[model samples]
Target: MPLNCGIVGLPNVGKSTIFNALTSAKAQAANYPFCTIDPNTGIVTVPDERLSKISALIVPKSLVPTTMEFIDIAGLVEGASKGEGLGNQFLGHIRATDAICHVVRCFDDPEVVHVAGAINPLHDIDIINTELLLADLETVEKRSQRVEKLARNTQDAKIKTEASAVAKLKATLEAGKPARAADLTDDERTASRELFLITAKPQLYVANVDEAGLANGNAYTEAVEKRAAEENSQVVRICGALEAEIAQLDPPERTEFLESVGLHEPGLDRLIHSAYRLLDLITYFTAGVQEVRAWTIRRGTKAPGAAGVIHSDFERGFIKADCYACEDLFKYGSEQAVKEKGLLRSEGKDYTVKDGDILFFKFNV
Candidate 1:
């Protein structure tokens, strides 16, 4: 399954607007709280210039780009963890995603109402973070109740280790820190995945600014950037209203509109790529006469693991991969040129796939 990033923020923070623009899907972008109660999911193609570049060289019949899922989760209110304003339902939706895109309202328009009666990006971030932390604290506390007994009464080493990990997580949450903030060992981190704490997922902040703010970030965006810097998180600034308008245009018109706005590319493209990188995702390609296709995998995926992304049978019967860096192809201008320079490699099962590798997996079922 493709990994997903959940769009979340307080009500009327342009989460739906950004989602609609990102996917070109008509999610209800009304001017009120909880406009989107149910999550709206859209599959977005990860844009890669290399796909077309490789296609140009291979002259393939078809070109397919890999896709990632984006889910527009309902706006989270202040007391969402306590079942306020469908908060429980929304939190569940967020917990299911691989990553989070926290959209913060950085633009001011008196015409549109703010849920908190004013715009304060830092305050808004704190409210959402507190709720998520509280929700995770509750989860850990409840799990501890059962595990504590097992650890103390039984001689099972696994249960004792889990109990200790749970205790560490609880302490961190109680201290108003996210679950990801806790220092965990590799084994504990792997085990904590089963807990599925919402705060443990990677996150990026989206600053929804006005047209003017897009060029030079406003005070609100500056505040967001400061907070993100302190947390070591990434912040992406975009004009939600303008992106919505751009999303409605045709291809030619969109190009013209972007040029008119003095932007080389739509901000949504930058936002998408930022979110993709936030998840530690990398793209590899399979170049063939039949097709030139892009594929998504984690950064350090081995040959068999990368093959498993294409097909389970391929991984089960994996041999080796005939691979060449896309850069070599671009530099040498042809497969024959790359071969002559010995840039192509036959990789074994233990080979870790690189981002722009053009691979042809050799397998026997």
Candidate 2:
């Protein structure tokens, strides 16, 4: 399954501008609202400095980086749950994503119109979140009604479990809390996934600030950070207009620009890393003389399941994995040195993968 984050926000909040910067794609960005009706998706590489370090040390002939997807969905409006302004289509696109990247307008530019008629980050957040909450509320209500009836009639444990999950979801949504904040068991969570609740997905906020707001956050960004902290989520501040300009530069020019700007890397890099973490993703590496590649896996994924990402046959004939931490290689300067130091180990199927692991899978098939 492709792990994707849907970019959502009110109109003219720089969602498309950020998307275009992240992917270097020509997604239409206009001063007006709803310029993007259909979602524009781009495959974005998950930047990890470790990947390059590994390639440099191993001196591979080819290096491949793992990637994720980003979808720029249509702008949302108030009463979106009630089918206002392409609401149904927008909600569908969001439901299809694995996570959400909410873009909040933190910059005040009188030229670009704000859909909510002013520059209030908190209000913008509320409008978008309220619509998603309302949509999820409807989904849970409908599911609860059906599942409750079926649970009363049938003796199936699965039906009973789903009914219980639906009840929890209904109560949470009615209380104005997101479905994700609802207390659900493992089985309940699995059951809830079938409903594709918009509020249930992991979310982070992107504060679209201007050039002045980049160095020290403006009041709008401070408000956003406070809200994100309350929800235990993170906020990444980016200057969308500036990032777009940086994206257009060549590699050498880009590096120079970043240095001159007193930044280690582009803001989009932080955004991508935050999104990857929000989705609970980790990267492992496979190194050889011919190629060094990075593979993405969910956090706490076991050896066999991770092997399956490479090929189905690998998992079917799974034996063990030769795993070593990439950090150990950085410390020791060679894989053979890692083995001598006993950092490398033969991991079994029960072994869980860790971030920055360099793995060599061994299977019969």
Candidate 3:
């Protein structure tokens, strides 16, 4: 999976608004549909409280936070799969992303026009989901025809495996299920990954609520929660307008603003943290008196793969790493204390990394 998420939803649902708040970039947010023609890509820093504590101790020359990309895609309307309202064009952009953040407008505003005529999250969700399903269905059916031809001529096991995989995908799509809904073996999954089907990507719902619903949530948000529960998806309720303003504040003022709202941190932090978890991403740290930095890796990443994310040379060296969990530092009060307590240890190439790990790599140039 790509280490990024794509923002998708109907037009005028504050998709661009939330995108701007998340990235701190001004993508045009207007009252009309299809304002975002091309997708806007932004890199957002992943916030970690542990990074702050590490920084306090290390006092590095500069601090660089780990980041994830978010792409703001154009709106999708009804009949999008059949080429309605720039449907195919937008769908192509979504397919390129690793995950999807579906923005639903839960706040009612007469000024900002609703493309669907009213605020109905379930209806809006159906419009986008149906289009994606249709697009994937078309792809599966087309591939199925070609695969059947190969299956007839070839006796090779690989060809037969692909043929069977495509047939299975076709059956699922025919039954109005997504390609992800189909069961496939490890080999079949490897073959299917080449297709990069949009419906196969994991998704989370983002309910953009008004200020009144930001804390406890309102009726529209309640409806979204119910629908998300049925789909086995997660929903995050936030006020995009409020977040935009908070993004512009200075650090001190930002803290005060959050306090006034009875929040210890911005909602965007929770959104970012949730997105990280939703992607099954984990963080590992490189710490020292010289520098302390956070790195992102997949949950099951081994030592070498995690090292490669920092630099290819680190992986090429293929040496051992001095590692300890960040919690050990917090618990024991310092690296020296942790070392004395026997919390620090050496890990080899096959070692699987854990979240909040503090690593010191020993390698020859």
Candidate maximizing lDDT? 2
Give lDDT tens digits, candidate 3, residues 1-365. 23999999999999999899999898999999999999999999999989988888667776767989999999999999998988889999999998899999999889989997988988998888889989988887888788889889989888788888888887887787777778988888778887788878888899999989998999999999998888778898889999999999999999999999887788788888878888899999998767788899999998888888988888888688899999888887888999899999999999999999998887665
Of the two candidates 1 and 3, the one with more favorable lDDT, higher being better, is 1
RMSD of each: 0.9, 1.0, 1.6
Q: In candidate 3, which residue ranges exceed 4 Å CA deviation?
A: none
Worst 10 residues of 3 by lDDT: 56-65
Q: What TM-score, over all chains together, does every model reach?
A: 0.98, 0.98, 0.96
- Per-residue C-alpha lDDT of model 2 across residues 107-196, encoded as one tens digit per residue: 988999998889999999989989999999999888888899999999999999999999999999999889999999999999888999
Separately for all candidates shown, the number of backbone clashes (residues 3 or more apart, or on different chains) is 0, 0, 0
Q: What's model 2's TM-score?
A: 0.98
Off by over 4 Å in 1: none
For candidate 3, the per-residue lDDT at 307 reads 86
Q: Write the per-residue lDDT of candidate 1 for residues 53-106, one digit (tens) a residue.
A: 999999998999999999999989989999999999999999999999999999
lDDT of 3: 0.88
* Comparison by lDDT, 1 against 2, better one: 2
